[model samples]
Target: MRVVLVSLLVVSVTCLPQGAPPTVCQTLMPFHGGGISPQGGIPPYSIIPRRQGGRVAITVTSSLGIPFQGFLLQGRTPRREILGEFDQTTTQDGHTIQCGEPADSLTHNNPGEKNSLDVIWTPPDGYEGPIVFNATIAQSYDTFWVGVESPPVDISRRSVINDPSFNIPRQPPTTTPHYARPIAKQSSTEFDPFYSGCAVTKLCFGAPDNCVINKSCKSAVAVTVSGDRYEFELKADNAAWVGVGLSDDDKMGDDSVIECVTRNNRVDAYMSWTSGPPNSYGAARLSNPQLGIQLLNGSVVDGVLYCKIRRDAYTNVNGKVFDLINEKYNLLIASGSSATASSVSFHDLSFLASAQKQSLSDVSALAAASKLLVRLHGCFMLAAWLGTASVGILLARYYRQTWVGNQLCGKDMWFAWHRTFMILTWALTTVAFVLIFVELKAWSAEKNPHAILGTVTTILCFIQPIGAYFRPHPGTSTRPVFNWLHWLIGNSAHIIAIVTLFFAVRLTKAELPDFVDWILVAYVVVHVISHLVLSVLNCTAEKSSERRVTSFPMKDLGASGRNSGYNDRSPDAPFSNVRKGLLAVYILIIIAIVIALIVITALAPIEETWTTLKSTVMDNN
Candidate 1:
C-alpha cells in the first residue's frame, strides 16, 4: 500500500477570476514510493545542488515498484537522453502490479531505478529569471502554456529540510540580456491612424499583404455590414494553422468546420485561424510566426481582431499522458470601425507552453523546404508524362508498321520500360501529393476542389500499359479508349503542370525557364492536329487496313475493358481532319488560359482578385 501526506498552501490568482482552481492547493502530494521521495511532477522540484560543473542530481528509489518506467528527460531546461525503458511488474503482497513510467514532464509518471535526475539550467550568460518548467505526459496533452509559480522562499513556516537556496548557485543569476525576455523588432511600417478599406489593403501585427478592396470591403481586411454573417481575418505565426469556418447549415456538419491551412513540417511554429465562418471579413493570413512579449497561443489579437491561441490537434497514445505541439494564431476582425478592444474572454485554455524564447533565425529554412517539395511534386507529373508518352508514341509507330500483334511487336525492350514507368509514376505521384501537402498550401489539391479533375486525367494515362501486358493483341476499337483516356489524363497533367510552373515563376521570377511554357503549348497544339489527320487516315484506309495495323503490345495501356471491342481509339469521326484541327484550336485556347492564370497569379495580387470577385458578385445581386 502507498502512504499519503497532504499540505494546504494559499496562493493568489489575479489573472484567473471566477471558477478558477481554489486559491489554495489543498492537497500537496509528496513524491513518495517506499519511504524515499520519487522525482516527478509540478514545480517546487527538490532542486539538487550542483555536483560537478553546473550539474544537479536527484535520486529516485521505490521499495514497492518502479517509478517512470520507460523514460527520457527532454526539452531545453535540462536536456537528458532516455536513460532506458522499463517494463517493471512488481508484486505487492503476492499480487502483480504494473507500475507506469517516469514523468518529470507530466503528472502520473513512475521513475524506475536511478529515478534521481541530473539537471543543469545554464541561463544565458548571467541570467536571473525563474527558469520556467512544463511537463507534457504525451502528444495528446492540451496544448497550453504553463505559468511559472515561484517556490516558497522562507523556512520559518516549515519549508522542507533541504536548504532551498542551495539548489541555485550562490553566484547570483545576472545577465546582460535576459533569455526570458525577447527584444522586440521595431517594424519600419507605420500603421495608418485613419483606416480606409482601400488604403489599408494589407494589415496585422506583422508583415502582411494588401486586403480586398471594394464598397463593402475596400480592402482585404475590411468589410461592410451584411444581411447575414460578419467577416473576419485570422493569422498564425511560426505554426501550422487550421481555420474554423462557422456556418448555420447543420447539414454541412458542424457549426464550425476546421480547414487545416499550415503545417508543422518546417518546425519553428505553425498557425491557423480560429475564425468562425463569415463573421465579418473573409479570413486572411496576416503574418509569419515570430517571438512576442506575450504569447497568444496561436492567434493574433489586435483589439479589432481577437484570436486566442490553443493546442494543436493530437491523439492520445497513453493513459492521461499527452504530448503538446507548439502552434501560432492570429485573428482578423471586420468591425464597423477599426477600434481595438481588450475584452477577449475564453474558457478551457490549453497551449504548448514554451519555457524558453527562440526565433526562426535560421534564414532560408522554410523557403528552401517548401521549394524542395514543389520541385519534387513537379517531377512526379513530369515522370508520369514522359514515361507514358515515350511508350505511346513509340508503340504507335510500331503498330502502324506491324499487323496487330505480329511476331516482331513484343520482341523488343520497349514493353519492359513501359510497365516500369507506370509503377514508378504511381508511387511518385502519391509521394508528391503527401510531401507538398505537409509543407504548405501552395499548389494544393485540397484548397481547390477543381484540382481533382486531374485525377480522372491521370487514370487514362496508365491504362494502356495493362491492356498491352494482358493480350498484346487488342482489336482496333479496343485500343481507342486507352488512347482517349491517355489523352484526357495527359491534358489534365498539362493543366497541373502549368500551375506548378506558375508557382515557380511567381516565386522566382528571374529563375523560371521559358521553354516549359512554349514546349507545352506547342506540343499540345501539334498533338491535336496530328490526332485528327491520323484518325482520318485510319478511317479512309478501311476496316481491313485498321485491323492490319497493330504493332507492339499497345504497350502503354494500363487500364482497359471491352465494349464491342475496338480498343479505345482517339480518332475524331465525321469531319475527322476538321475536328482534329478544332481540337488543336481548343489546345491553343487552354494554353491562353494557362498564360492568363500565370499572369494573374504573378502580376496581379490576390487582394485585387478578392475585390474583383466580391464586386462582380455584388453587381449581379
Candidate 2:
C-alpha cells in the first residue's frame, strides 16, 4: 500500500505543471482550469517591430515595465493565418512550434518570469502581403490576456528600372497615365477595369450616387455575377482599408465582410466577420477551412486602393450560408485608417448602407440610406428655438410698453406679434419633435446628453401653451400664481433648449465642426447684451416720469390697481424711440444667427463640403 501511494503522489505532482501547456500553439489558451476569466483591462505587454532587408525582428516587452512569466507570439496574415518562420539563432527564452506550418509560431519554454523576449522572423519567399506580430502574455498561469498585436509591417517589393548608361535605379511612376480616361478592356494594363461595367452589366454602389460614372468615389463596390461565380471590386481613396459587408438588415452585427486593405504599399483582400460594432472586440477574422474566395488583382496607386476578388456564389460564414443569386442582402460599405491582422478599427472616414436589400444578380444602382430626414430635423429645431422662440420672448418681455397705442385686429400690437410668434414656435417645435422620432425610429443609443435634454425641452414647451389656455383672468386672485408659473416654465424651457443645442455639436450624426461651439457662444453673448441694454433703458424711462409707473403691462402685472404695487402707463411712455431701434437691431442679429446655424446644420460634415468648395474656387481662379 505504501508503494502504490508513492506512485500516485508522483503522478499528481507531474500533472500540476499542466497550467502552462507545451502544446499551446493550436488553441493559444492556458490550461489553468479554475474558471478564471481573462483580464479585461489593457494588456501590460506589447510587440514592437524592427525590420531589416527581408527579415523582421520582433521584441515582446512589458509596456508597463512589469515582468511576465510566459508568452506565445506568431507572425500572421491579415486573415489571422499563421505565416513566417522564426530564426532559431536569434530567438531567446523561447522555442519555435508547428502551428499548421513548421516553425511558424513561438512560445516560452519555461515558467520563469522574464522582462522581454526577442526573435527574428522571415516571410515566405516572394510573399508581399500585410503581416503583423500577435502575442499572448501570461503574467501568471491564471492571469493572461489574448489578442495583443503589433502595428502592421510593410514588406512589399519595389519595382525599379536600372539604366545601364548611368548605373542608377529609378522607382516606377506612382500614377497611371490612363487613370483619368474611360474604362478599358479587362486585358489592358493601361487602365483599371473597376468602373467598366458598373450599372450596365454589374450592380454598383458608391457614395455621392454618381461616383461610378464620375470616377470620384471616396469608397465604392461593384458585384458581377457569372453562373456560380460572383466577382467583387472595391475601391477607396486615402484609406488604410475598405470593406463591403452582406448583412440581413441595415445594421452591422452578424454580417460577413470582405475587406481590401492597403499595407506594405500594396493591397490585399481578406474575409472577416462583424460580430458587433467595428471596435477592437467586435470584428474578427473568419477561420473557415475553405474560404472559397480568390484575389485576382490588387494595387495602390495615387492614394487609391483597389482590389478585385472572385467568390463562390454560395459561401458559408460563421455557420450560415449566404446565397448571392436568389436572396437579397443590404450592402454596408466602410473605410478607416487603421487595421490589425485580426480586426479593423472604427470606420471614421466613411460608412453607409444601402437603402434597401439588393439582389447581387440584379444590375441596378443602389441608393444610400437617406440622411435627409436628419438634416430636416435639425433645421426645424434650429428655426423654432433660435428664431421664432427668441423673437416671441423678446416681444413679450421688453417691447410690451414700447408698442403701446398701436392696435391690430382689436389686440395690442405687442400682444398680436407675440402671440403669432409663440404660436409659430409651438407648431415648429411639435413638427420638429415628430420628425426626429421618425428619423431615428427609436430612442437614441448615444452616450451624450443631447437626446435626453431635447426630449425634456419638448415636453416643457408642449405643456406651456396648455397651461396658458386655462390661466385665470388678469384681476383674479390666482392671477399672480398663473403669472409666476408661466414665467418659470417659459424661461426654463428656453434655457434648456439652448443648452441642448450646445450638446448637439458633439453628436456624431451632426458632424458639425468644432467652430460651431463658438457660433453658439456668440449668440449667447449677443442675447445677454441685448437684455442688459433693454433693462437699463427701461429704468431710465421710469425714473424720468413724474409719477411712479410700472414697467410691466397691466396684463403682465395681473392684479387690480390697488391690489398690487403696479399701474398701467400712458401710451406715450418714455424711451419709445430708443426701444424701437434696439428691438430692430436685436431682430436683425437674431435672424442672422438663426440663418447661419441652420445653414451649418443642413451642410453638416461641413469640413468636407468646405474643402470641396475651396477646391472649386481655386480651380475657377
Best by lDDT: 2
What TM-score does structure 2 among the candidates reach? Answer: 0.56
- Per-model TM against the reference: 0.29, 0.56
Cα misplacement distance, residue 60 of candidate 1 (Å): 67
Clash totals in order: 98, 0
Runs in model 1 deviating more than 4 A are 1-357, 360-368, 390-394, 397-399, 402-434, 437-447, 458-519, 533-621
lDDT of each: 0.29, 0.71
The CA root-mean-square deviation of candidate 2, after full C-alpha superposition on the true structure, stands at 15.1
Tens-digit per-residue lDDT, 1-621, candidate 2: 999999876653332322234466655665555444677744656565655456665766652356677777888887778888886556436677778778888777666666666667778777776677877788876678877766456654523222122211111223321112111122321123345556766788865444555545668898978787898878887788988999998766788889888765445678888865434224577775228778765655446666678888888888999988889999988777777766667775667778889899888888777778788888888888888888888777777666666788877777788888878888888898998877766666455799999999899899999998898766778878877787778889889999999999877567678998998898889888988888788778778988443445435555533434322435646788888888899889889998998899887766556655776788899
- Indicate the worst ten consecutive residues by lDDT in candidate 2: 176-185
**Per-residue lDDT for 1-621 in model 1, tens only?**
122222111112111111112111112122122122233322221121122122222112111122222222212222222111111111100111111223112222222112222233222233222222222111111111123221111111222233333342111223221121111222311122112222222122111122322222211121111222222233332222323322222111122222222222111122222233223212232243221111221211121122222322332221121222232222221111211121111201101111122111111111100134445555555454433443335334332332223233354233344345456655665675676545443342122333353444344444534544553244544565655555455445545544444334323211234445564565455655655555555455445443432332333343343422234233322333443354456445544544544444332334444665676899999
Root-mean-square deviation of Cα positions for candidate 1 versus the true structure, in angstroms: 24.9
In terms of lDDT, the poorest run of 10 residues in model 1 is 360-369
Deviation from native of the Cα of residue 158 in model 1, angstroms = 68
